[model samples]
Target: MQDEGIGSNEVHDIISAMDEHFNPRDLKVGQDVQMHFEPGADEGSYQLTDMRIELNPLKTLTVSRTDDGFKSNLEEKEVKEVIQAQKAVIKSSLYGSAAKAGIPKTVVSDAIKIYSQNVDFQRDVQSGDTLEVMYETHQTEDGYIAKTGNVLFAQLTLSGRKIPLYRYETADGSVDYYGRDGQSTKKTLMKTPIDGARMSSGFGMRRHPVLGYGKMHKGIDFAASTGTPIYAAGDGVVQRAGRFSSFGNYVRIRHRSDLDTAYAHMSRIASDVRPGTRVKQGQVIGYVGTTGRSTGPHLHYEIMVGGKQVNPRGVNLPVGQQLAGRDLKKFKAVVGEVDSQYAAKSGAAVKVAQRQVESQDDIN
Candidate 1:
């Protein structure tokens, strides 16, 4: 090696009795070489750090100075426009369902809005909570997401409360809310075309939240939270699913005998169960998301029955089982007396009201 004049900063490669190899360049300050090698031509050891080999991409390897060790701070989400760039990955993935189910892209956008209405979602949702949604999607001939889809189930899990809402039917030709236990949660049919809280924004009315111009609210707004689950307010099938720059993700559910419902602003949906599948009461259909014409997350629950608009709260739900003899008597007495007391008091805001007062009034 000395005869070859390989300097301290240089390296040597040879094919000989030892099949030996020498290091390249002087070891840097505080730097050392680690090696792996084969036995030499006769019996000497071969050194690895001195040799070059094809790179192995699968192996985990690192080379660094002592001044700093590896430090990794990686966030969970990414921003990619294409489908493959999806950052929110899940075991029970929702986008896959939209594709397979033939839901329109717009419907999904609406669903996100619907989900966002749950106030708690924006402030208190935990990492491990589950969001199970069932929605529909339309596809291109190539099986790509052509449009958004309608949500059949949108269930969100929080600390302890599980809000199970449904799109169900009564034995008598009417569709309305039903608890998962098959019990009715509805006091009556939504008098208007939409449900949830009082109209945050009204129909046929206009006032741009941003610009000073006035625009029609078209439908009503129901306050909720980001990531909150939205339900189909009645038994129906998805009519449209697509994205509208203004609407964001949206879904329209068409019901039997000329009834329909619309949900807007959603994050995503469940991977299984599509447009035509029948959904029962209290089904988790979609999650609230902010994607449309307004601020913050909330549901825009709209209903259209008989082609005319009406407040969802005032709509007559028909009557449930007609509270028979004993139950009927008890029910009427109880209900009537309370109404009478309220009518009598009218404006009594003294201390506070008590359930007993109402009960006693009913008994009388």
Candidate 2:
């Protein structure tokens, strides 16, 4: 029997009603639960009529107690999906320009992640540089955004060079962003591993600042504030992550059979970072500091090849994967789709801008 607060006194009916779809113990605090009750034939007794529970934004479960037992049903809801595209010119920073253009922070962050493989946003992006983004936003029918969707495509025009990337997935279920030529943007190692830092020193024979004598500077130095994050140059296992005599807090990662990178003068090493711990590219391994020797806060970075220190900026790093065979065929189709989408969206934006300008002219 259904207990709608009707004349059903049987506890078995209430148990049966909940057993079909949901457990009463699993109910959350913010969820809505409704119960219907009515007077029974006897003054002292009541009957249970019906009950409803909102499962989530898109679904609801309802139970009705009847003479036979409890009947249960699920109700579905409808939502709307909105597509958005935006463009902006860099004035101060990418974040500021994107915000001014009404681009969501999450989407802007995604764009930066995609571009970080090659462009150093901290260094490369300048005033007058342009950025374009095409993405989607999921919203309820009531116009409230539920969440942001993927960055379908993004383009960064920096210093007259237009770098365009399209999001695509390989047939093997791997997804990544690729250039217009179907080559991946991600490389074997990142050039500038740290964010918001400048090259204070380069690899060469120079007088050591603390040692006060002419010596070969094996590693490059990036001057940054203490506690700035330091990332792994590539996917590698930690070879060393601890304090040393002159290096202070130091970390070394082995990327290949012949390749390795080292970071010195860290405020603190990431707790999870240790010898034999595998770290991916861009994973924060430590923070900047002047821990070991005499110097202001900075990161002493080194790239070693075959046991010899090499210039990171000089080494020709292996480029990202090139799509071929079936993958290439699939990627070409994706490129076509992205181009069409971008063109359509850009055209629409241009028309809107032109209309606005014409209207302004008429007003003037």
Candidate 3:
């Protein structure tokens, strides 16, 4: 307001009115602010009459100077939901492949989370594998994507085996990803608790990096940067969440079926997580860090079954709920619709690519 030469009193009144509809402190950096001016009493002078601030792509806050006082109103634009589909062959990583296909990172992350129940991205996802995803996006009147929604369908082809999962809501309003056979994609536990991290070490005998001696490594290590979010492997109650010997920051969750998952070497545990506190699957429990007796930033993850440590990759995790009868029938119809949409979108994309190629040939 000072830079724009608005009087202090007017600025204060304008802000007070704006606060009625929106918080001024919540303004994001680089957000758009528009000011309208009218002729002042003095010649060649202009006075501020109205101000508009873009809260987001879909919302705008407008403050107009009225005869009584300044008044503010929040204007929201309507958006239409659109379904989009993308298919890509993995050349190196799923992130890279999805980027090339113009898929949003959030959608790709959701797909990874859905598949993490059974597929190991680091080990199972190899070059030549294929990924297909169909998702929803809310677009403004101008066709700008305002928000990316859920992944309605996803498919992964590994070594010629195609695994397809469809998003469905049950009669009880529970939503989850289900395979073609109507089996929920959720397993008893996730194979990897964190995303975009490399497995530095596996469970078994290995030379301890800090100890400089061969030792039986009971837990698998995921090497990630400090502060990387660590997720709970499954829905469970926190058994312990504190510092321990050789483990900087540790969190242990006691899950069902006599299974327990432990995360070690966290930079900091989430404030809400504590002993006896129940946590949902894929919930963030802590952040990756080398807290105690460590060499570098990494997560030492372990799965205990019947009080015995086991390799997470090799463990036979129990499958989730199996849809049947009416639920299964509804899911099949959803799958068919998704498949049809994907096919139509894929065909359009192919035609667009062909047109680009022909246009380039003409230019040559």
Candidate 4:
């Protein structure tokens, strides 16, 4: 190769222009070659600060772009407005009654309290009852009753179709339960023996435990957890009990007249339980378990009348005691107020309803 003998000034300028390009003449004919160059200001090249990369302000969900420089799935949300839903007002009215137009009291009372455990209108009711209720709805963010409230005016119907009501004040007030005809359901004892407790098994069935064979189950089985207390099925005095072979850990009670009941297969009997002990209905008699000749855990219950076992869970299961005359009238009045409560937009009340859900981050 011939030396060009270029000017010293030209050589100096070339080295200054490209500092990293040292071996520049290593090219061969028809050979592959690669070269990297740093952009310069003089040759329309830009520094990093001068170069611009356009970016969209919105978030994109598409991995591949379309021909139009936009993805098919990129949705643009329009910012309109958000309206806070208002709740309907809560009002107190007749829930049920035997008077004219009304549902059964027991069924309605059971239905109303289901929402909030704390309700005051439960008291003051009789078997043959009637009621009348009056109350106003409130205004709330989601509406009024949508917010949740107590009884406004409770009108309890009595035996003679008399209605007595206790008004519920909105501004932090005490709740009072009363009956129509100026009567009260709040007595020393409740009418129903069992309230929330569920019956695991009923009297009369086909099952065996000791021999592991199918046999006639004479009594009912209340399958509660081990250590769960068993209540006396009725008001009775403890009779024959203690430890029996087949009826392992039993408690027999003699009730009024010719009625009697027995609880067996108990893990343990209460210390208070003994012969001649007077027990009330719903009182703890024993704990449920797989004692005696039992296959699994259960409460063996039996109800005897005139010294004979009968179906305790018969459809005609007896109520604690039915009230009549003035007592019945007062109960119906309370039911009246509970029935009208549905007027407060709880879904069936409104023609159109929308449920709103907000994330914690969004709400704040």
Candidate 5:
């Protein structure tokens, strides 16, 4: 404001008023800022009258000179909720394929987390597998998507076997994903506790990477980037959380009287997670790192029964939430509605693609 020949006192007042509603530090490069000035009492001076800054696509912050001083207010634009569908054929990874299909990264992450309970992405998701997702997005009046809402439905086809899930809310307002049979997609434990990780090592007798000798590997190792979040495999109370010998920054959660899950080699444990702290399924526990006796950034996970380590993949996890009676009927109705929406959106997408191809042919 000073550079524009406006008085410093006026600039200060304007900034102070804006601060009441917004943080100046949040101003980003290329953001739109509008300023208005009026002639001041001095011969060559100007007074800052009004200023408006675009906070985001849906919000605007305005500061205006008032009788009391300068006043700031926030204005928000309403957005329309739009249901959309996207389908992708996996060429490499699910993330890559979803990106190619123009699916938002957050939506893909949510789908991965939802399927982690039953599907092992590293093993089950392969090339040529088909992934379909129906989700909600909030769009501005001009049809610009302001934000993504939730995944309404997700379907994965592996080896011609289709696994479909629908987001349903029960009578008690509990929301969960259910299959056609109305059974919840959740299992006793998640097959993978972290997202976008590759299994670097499996549980079995193998030569230790650091020790250079064959030994029984009690846990599986998932290699991911440093600071990647690690989630609790199931709802449990933290039995132990702290630095241990070879398992630096470890956390052990007791899910049942005889069942326990352990996560090791975290860069940092979540501040809220401590011994005796209860955690829900999919809650973040720590971040991946090479803190213990490891060669790279990864998570070492183990499941113990009767204090003995067992192969996590071999454990027969119990099914969760078998809907019956009225709940099942409601879920079936939800599934039918989601199916109709998905079909309509998908059909429109196909028509758009066909038109694009025809236009290219005509141009050629």
Candidate 6:
């Protein structure tokens, strides 16, 4: 206000009023500020009649002179929630193609993660495949997106097979993505609980490196750099956490009846993960390290079934909850709604594509 050449007392009053709504110091560059002034009763000075600052596309803060003093208020632009459908051919990768199709990066990443249980991006996705996604967003009246919601529906076609999934909430208030057959997309456990690691050893009989004798390797070993985060394979209560002889920094979780997963040779265990503590799937339980009777930095991961260690790769894990009866009916209704909305927006999408092509042709 001083830079604008207002009188010191008047500037103080105006800024004080503005501070009641928002701090002027919090303003960012490129944010527009408009000031309207009227001639004061004296010829030498001008009165600040109105002041407006654009906070965002949907919100504005304004200060106007009132009978009592300067008054500040916030103005909100009209916003509405809308469903947007986007589809693209996979020329390279799902992330790239979805981005070109106008899907938000966050939504693309989230959709990929949800589908990772069923689809391998490197192996399953190929050129000429197609992806269709429908999601919700809160947008301004002029179509500026304010925020986005989860993918309501997603479809990926590989070769001649098409997989369609819908976001559904169960009567028990749990939400998860489900296929057309009402089966959840989540598995009992993640195939690999750690990210960016390679399997160094298999779960089978081998010559024990430390013992120098033939022995059963009860767990799989993932070679990773020290401090790489290790995640819990499934939601379970920690049955035990601590050092145990050769299994240094061991943490075991009991997931289900006769099912338990264990992580050993951890550099550090998560502070909150202890015996009897419940942890959700994908929760970080520890970090990889060569803490046990091992030769190098790696994670010793084991899945025990019926008190016997099993091969993690060959284990037949169970699928998540299946919607049946009334729940299935409701899920199908949701799927139908998503399909209708996608079809409704198909024409609009085609027009947009055509307009872009025509504009490019004109430029060329």
Please give each candidate's TM-score. 0.35, 0.68, 0.77, 0.39, 0.79, 0.72
Q: Residue 198 error for model 4, in Å?
A: 10
lDDT of 2 by residue, 141-163 (tens): 75445678999899999988999
Model 3, stretches more than 4 Å misplaced?
1-78, 358-364
**Prediction 1 global C-alpha lDDT:** 0.44
For residues 109-161, write the lDDT of model 1, one tens digit per residue.
Answer: 44333343332233345544444334444444334544443443344455555
What lDDT score goes with residue 156 in model 5? 93
Residue runs of model 5 more than 4 Å from their true location after superposition = 1-77
lDDT of 6 by residue, 219-300 (tens): 9998999999888887789999989778899999998878899999998899999999998776789999888798888999
Tens-digit per-residue lDDT, 1-364, candidate 5: 6777766887788888888789888898788889898887789767778889989778899999888999999998888999889999999878889999888898999888888887888888779999899999998886668889989999999989999988888888867788899888776688789998888999999999999999999999999999999999988899999899899899999988898999999999999999999997788999999897989999999999989999999995653678899999878888888899899999998898999999999999
Off by over 4 Å in 2: 1-83, 120-126, 136-150, 350-364
* lDDT at 193, model 3: 94
Candidate 4 ranges with C-alpha deviation above 4 Å: 1-207, 212-216, 222-224, 313-319, 338-364
Task: Kindly indicate the candidate among 1 and 2 with the higher lDDT.
Answer: 2
TM-score of 6: 0.72
**Per-residue lDDT for 1-364 in model 4, tens only?**
0123334653344434323322224323543322223454468552211111111222122212223321223322233222111221223343423212322343234223321111223343444554333334333333323212334343334345544333322123423333333332222122223233345555555655466667777776755667777766556689966898888899988865677778888888888998889886556777877778776667777777788887764523232333456545555665565445534423432344322223444676
**lDDT for each candidate structure:** 0.44, 0.83, 0.90, 0.47, 0.89, 0.85
- Cα error, residue 63 of model 6, in Å, equals 2.6
Using lDDT, rank the candidates from best to worst: 3, 5, 6, 2, 4, 1
In terms of lDDT, the poorest run of 10 residues in model 5 is 315-324
Please give the lDDT score at residue 164 for candidate 4.
Answer: 36
Highest lDDT model number: 3
lDDT of 3 at 255: 87
User: Cα deviation of 182 in candidate 3 (Å)?
Assistant: 1.1
lDDT of 1 at 358: 80
